[model samples]
Target: MGSPDPLEWDFSCPDWEQRLRDQRSLLPDLPLDEVEASRAVSIFDRLRLPDVPGQPAFADAAGDWARDMVRAIFGSLVDGERMVPELFELVPKKNAKTTNGAAIMVVALLMNLRPRAEFVLVGPTQEIADLAFQQASGIIDADPDGYLQKRFQVQEHVKTIVDRTNNARLKVKTFDLKVATGAKPAGVLIDELHLMAGMPHAARVIGQLRGGMIANPEAFLIFITTQSDEPPAGAFKAELDYARAVRDGRIPQGRVLPMLYEFPEAMQIAEEKPWRDPACWPMVLPNLGRSITVDRLKKEFRAAREKGEAEERRWASQHLNIEIGLALHSDRWIGADLWPRAVDVTLSYAELIARSEVIVAGIDGGGLDDLMGLGLIGRCRETKNWLGWGHAWAQPEVFDKRKEIAARLQDFADEGDLTVCEDPTEDIRGLADIIEELNTLGLLPAENAVGLDPQGVGALIDELSGRGIAEAQMIGIAQGFRLSSAVWGLERKLKDGTFVHAPQALMNWCVGNAKTEQRGNAVLITKQTAGKAKIDPLIAMFNAVSLMGRNPVAEGDNNGGLDRYLERLSA
Candidate 1:
């Protein structure tokens, strides 16, 4: 069927009018206050749109979707207290997200009954914060009747607007702890919340922001954001996932009202990718015919596609609200496109051991500031397929040095795929312990069971020697073009449907980050080419692949030895 009109229905949602109906009279969810909503609308009606063609007031410029968002934000109030604590709206870019957010905050400021209270607009960066200030100040400045101008004080340098009558201030700030620290606010508008997801202390900052609201019964939080340019991680992922759950009615509602703009789940999973169709573009674009048009977006999308896969992915993520999946970029590894197809999510450590006849390991990159990656490749007992798993370890210095990927690394840590160690002594010991466990089960080959890069592996060698791993059990794998066979072999195995890996975010990220090239007669993926994207774990996987190709047998013929020794170790 075709999309519903924005004036009558929520076009993006597959459920359509169900959520709005539920919010009206559902128990634990009180009815939306039309009086308070009208009050909020009056505030919006006063705010003029300066840059638009007609210079219409917000009441005229806002579509039903915008009005619905405004009503849900304000109509949750009964008397002077807020019924809903938070409202989350996710929309695509070029929809005036910044301007809409500014208008909402201004209405919030005007509706505040608390004296000397604070209304804050928080942006993830300084530039975003400045833009918010300009839009909000412009709204007041554009008032020809001196209505808002006479009641509020706009301080350009400080980026603050103070209500002259009530002594309340609306402050615009870049993401800072001080915004959430020690201060209680009547209302807060978190602009572009997705951008804050990558901050090192995203959870803590959000917690603090919410924590401050405990004191004010009338407090409200409005989060307006666009789809992230990269894969969502950290706080962004958590909130976005929660919003989806709430919007889908999988989670109970009333406390949080989510207005998510994106393709319906069914259409999103369609075989042909319905979101890619120009006809389906309007499904997610609620601002259609106003802030943006299908033709303009189609033109931009065509340009992005012509540039390369990477550019296209970024554009689709921002515009169509499509979550970025695996890289699958042309310049990426040979197996990049095939990696997702070869996932066996049930492949855990115990599962690997239970299914494998023999297992080989690869270790790479043990620098203090670098991530030390370990890959385990196992030959299946019956299927004869290869099962893969990976783990990574890093020190505190990694977080400080690689701040850009720190949030993602922290996410990996939370999933138990990566460990952050403080003591260097305990770090190598952890890897050694895993190697020792596999050897104890007699699952490892008698010779050359473990493959490691020879460079910067002196410490690992010492630890392994202490655990009684002889030199032959741990062979040094050559790097760069020399290991091309394993590189090509892994791709062939994945494509031939003989090799599959545990569905792991760490491996997915590393695989996506990998860049490959043909060097003379050999295909190679080097750390130098991968740069800061960190493909150490993938290199380690290749090292394991190199040894697995040898087809060596376990010490005890891989018999009843595994269950016996592993149970005893647990005891």
Candidate 2:
């Protein structure tokens, strides 16, 4: 129940080898029942490899380090009870994770003491579920003495293996919240957790699966996954963070064991970049010679680097398990790298409005085939930091024409960050309505606060004025080199951590798509340079920041000054 003992790591660590040794030494030394652990390993070892030429022993095919890891996991105990109720194993691709997971499930089924118990293996897709089931079924059929055949009945059609003596069964299933609704599982295995991170129902399904464990004290849950190429988000990131906390002894283990096969913190941040070095590859690769070879990795890495920067970064993320920062394009805006660090999920629209003395609106009216974006930026009364929120609207016809980005647009629509309106004209009205609502809330300034592109906003200006917004409030923000100061200010705010925004997926995507161009000594982000990608939301942010730089609200008197300004406008 206490925090982990102080770590022996510091930035001054001499080399990666020393940091790695220190990390391995920090693993918790819980009470372990050697007898039970050996028995579990014996069951696992008896399961034959399905794919090998002669169907070699699972122990031999899994390699020594993997076998030992399995032994340590199953054998560990606390007060003579199961010490690890949950286990997380994060490794790179082609590491024999699927086969190893199947073996672990078989061992778990054989070791369960409770009669009529149910064990489940959940995969992100049906194909993956079937693959694991085939591996488990093959293991059961490979028993030479008919020990497993006589003890258990394999039902391939239903993907279940039932122990005849105890009436216990192990089943493979794809992620489904309804299937897990009332099922009580003695043990659960989640495969490719990163694939499910983007699923809207992933959290609910996982909660249901783990919730059934209350009746069984010895129940176990295991997660096996590879790093995602996209940004780490949702449940996968949350679980990974907690596992790391427990691994480092920063938090109590609490029946959880984390085996993370990744670079140490110090080595990961090394000036010489040890993680990128071929010599350090073996440090993170426990199953190096068996599942993967350094020669193949080196060859593949060389080819990937030659292809392009994005390909190289993707290869490193998948093969090396290194989390590269978020950048969609190679020539991305300078602020794109720091965008992830500026996210404050707790900053809601209502909270931002309440805390700020004044709010400015920014609009980017992208063409018929692109998104129309509206953004709000406010300066916090106490902290003086800028808080932002944005949403985009697109006509359904745009998706019909732009088939390439249609799926991505649909995903943003599903997340509530983007809206697909029936008519293109509705987007302008929608944005005008938002401004009127904020103005009624007394957050928006009565004049000179809404900044937008001057060229194509005659209709928009009329709509805003109809909604009680003064004509003087709609200021024209010059495009190209003239707006360089705004771009530079936004970059400075991001780097200084003086800017924060709610996690808006649409905005994140737009920012990632932005590419910069230099005009004389100034920098500019233009849609023409961004190609087919939509950077409307990010452009809207820049427009809002440009207006906010004018400081429409007086200093030192945050609330009363804004109230008096609004009162004089109304009179």
Candidate 3:
């Protein structure tokens, strides 16, 4: 790949309203079977809702929003066949996604022309699968008339619903490779696809399911999910991104139609934050008058805000369809909460050096399976504000050891925040070269400018020492509670919008992974507290903050002495 762009684009859809209209438009002109579509909607409407107040049928309890979504998903058929083989529906929580999946699968069974066909209902776990099966069975049991009972049989022990006459069976199973090994299902419904995204076999399982669906030409697969609580990753991210592109008209819809319940980019990123306004909550909450209520959601949102920033974010992501970009862990460093706001993508490594009176650095060591992080903090020559840049290096083993985050690591690599080195010594040499170049520049302070963790500083020190960088330039930043001042100081800078960093996804991930603990009145952030999630880059930044917090000044020629050290870097 070529050099990554130093300028980060804050993309907001200016034609969001038009795009939204196109996405949710009913395909009325398709070669659809009007009778079958009407019949399917009728069947869906007759399905009983036992849990809802008054135990009304779906027609009585469901709002127009749900009825439309159900119609768009299940009833649209071309030449008596399903129009789209696959549909992705990303809705907020409490929209009855699972129940809707069940209802549509029942409609598919009733209207299906194929005999002895298979239908699949998949969930991320057995517990989730069981709950979906319960909903399916409950809908069946709620029918006061004997028609549905005589027409179909629901076996609770096996979590199977069978159509008696057609011998078509719908089997509920957790998402697993073995689930789709041999079956050719007439229709498949996947509930909470976001949860299954993290599964190692999610892609393979989905591939197998798609293959199974291909065996039945008229079959359809529906994926119903809510936004992930955390930043999107893995198979979920892939599909979500693709679906969004299609919804935005960046790509042809082809066989997949995405019905995503999300705020327009303008509302989501607007300075006013209209998404957070209680009056605008109904825009995303399709079930506002039915299963969901505006006042109830407002009350819950207020309670979540009182809990903590993390809880508030979680509540927003779940109920308001607000995308989560920050740390949701209650113990996450406070700096992480404001990290997005402090993003100055225009701040590059060269820009940081060019605009700074002095620049200090930090280094954090990691094992073969982890990243070596370098963070630079430059105090702006004019504004006196600290501008930060971060980079991480990792051995190839990181992919093997942390396979779950390998995709995200590759994303960081693409974004130029990380480098995957062929050799461990190569990473050290890279760090030493950047430091040597910094020292040659006038911005790096002559003494106590580089703060490093002492645990594994030998290799870097040896390389830098050979280059004539004095040992006095490197100071060991105390870990744990002792570095509390730097930790707190960085938070203050970020909160007041002074500490600016090159908006890197790597930094965001590290910030989200970071967890802070109060130790004897000091806030301590440690890798040990972050569990397996890598926070080396963030730790290194705090280390740099510790050194910069001392207000060191460079003695070298500030303008012309050193060559561009960062032009070699991708960013």
Candidate 4:
């Protein structure tokens, strides 16, 4: 089969309204205990809105959609099956997600009925955890008759609300895996889960939270968050993809119900960019006019646009609930816009070698502090697309030196896109062997195809020469403005959908990190201008693209000269 569709990269729930309607239709066939659902809604509705002026009851503050959603989540039941064990809710910011989360936990605590049942509310940071705790505490304090106070012991110091009746307790904590390791939670509310996307151990922590759910069928785990300003990756991307898949009816037996507030696929892919129109903003902002106003958003957007392109992209991502990749800077590599569309995970290294008539390799690296990057670019004979694969290696010492990006590095390591070498020399030898192996297989260019940064490649050149790769094959590529044509050529391939790459997180991160600097008539992408981010792999790709552009291979020519060279080598 061909590669998976590039559109799958966008995990936005475009058909959310139809998904909700389908869910509502299933309620009748679900054997739902309306009485239990009604009771849960009633308990939740009794809680007061702490943010409101006079602390109005939740029922009064909640909109119709909120009340119905809460009912479906807590009250729905089946005879011998769990209605929904997980809930993924995505909404824009300023929608009172925290307040609603607090109320949901309160209702869960009231309805537990199980002795010593534990309900946990987790936040990405301590401040957010404390904010949730405060919201719940405020609701408890606002009860005029001391109903909540009399029924539960509010311990602000410990961040717990203990139910006097069943000894059940509700607690709030940050995303510390150590804290969640052994706890048997009856329900978990993960607030702002998008923030924990890059937390290397997020999957492990979530597994621990759901570990006890198999025993407690009534257990529910709810992930509530605003869309992240950066591209989704790691645990967040996994969960969001699964949620979207389940919502779209692709996974018939999934136990997760997704309620995502965003633009539909048609609007998202529209030629006129309807999503940018203010008239369509309210379609995604369900809590508009209540928590946030259109006028406020318009004012903020106006100011953001004036600030710069990156700022405006961030504003749209956060305010309009758009899921997008990073907005590095105004003069970012033109390829940045097309990279997302070039992802094709089905293009494995073996598949590339098997299909390509000839391949060109690029090597870019420095000392232990920098990443050692290798890129392979080839013309596939079958589809005729320019397929590419990239790998990067870093020393363990980088983790300590670049502490700010430690988690991100760990994430890339976990995804197998990055190699953490104990000895920097091992990276040089390993990359050399990889290129040598591909060259021995008769897939690589016969000569003058392997591009390397002119400087800092003495060891690599020596290694490749030792492996029978001639010095003539190792061409030195110039850096800076000299490589502007290669950069522009790669951007053209990406935009034309002729450039394809195997899904590699480190490569994507490197591509996103690249920012261009205009040097006279030529534009240059440099690590110096990209701040602390690493763009070594992308630089390597640019070097390889320059060599590929020089080759005399015609597009869609199955009997190209490279194919004859490969055939003669095999003979």
Query: TM-score, each model?
Result: 0.90, 0.69, 0.83, 0.83
**Candidate 3 Cα misplacement greater than 4 A, ranges:** 1-36, 50-55, 73-83, 143-145, 182-186, 253-255, 269-273, 348-359, 379-384, 394-416, 419-449, 463-473, 550-571
Give the clashing pairs for model 2. Answer: 448-473
Q: Compared with the true structure, what per-residue lDDT tens digits does model 1 show for residues 431-454?
A: 899898788778998899999999
Clash-forming residue pairs, model 3: none
Whole-model lDDT values for every prediction: 0.81, 0.77, 0.79, 0.77
Q: Which predicted model would earn the best lDDT?
A: 1
Q: Per-residue CA lDDT of candidate 3, range 58-131, in tens? A: 88766555555556555555544555667777788987778877777777778787889999999988888988
Candidate 2 regions off by >4 Å?
1-27, 63-69, 76-81, 253-255, 264-274, 327-448, 452-473, 476-510, 513-537, 545-571
Q: Assess candidate 1 and give its lDDT.
A: 0.81
User: By lDDT, is 1 or 3 better?
Assistant: 1
Residue-level lDDT for 457 in candidate 2: 90
Local error of candidate 3 at residue 12 (angstroms): 15
Highest TM-score, which number? 1
Q: Any runs in candidate 4 off by more than 4 Å, and if so which?
A: 1-29, 76-83, 212-217, 269-271, 338-358, 379-388, 394-430, 441-443, 488-506, 518-524, 552-571
Q: Estimate the Cα RMSD of every predicted model relative to the unseen true structure.
A: 5.4, 8.0, 6.4, 6.4
Question: What's the lDDT of the predicted structure labeled candidate 4?
Answer: 0.77
Pairs in clash, predicted candidate 4: 37-75
lDDT per residue as tens, model 2, 1-571: 2222223211121233454544342233444567877888888887898777888887777755455546655775444244567877887887888888988888887887789999999888999999999888888888878798889899988989999989999999988676588888888899988777666567678788778876776778889888877656556766777777766656743445677777876665454667777887876666677779999999999998898767876887788777654645577788887787799888866667667878898899666888888888988978988999998999976777775566557667867888899765789899988887667666776567899988789889899989988877789999888878999999999999999998877788788788998878998798898888788888888999998888876223445545654575579
**Residue 538, candidate 1: how far off, in angstroms?**
1.0
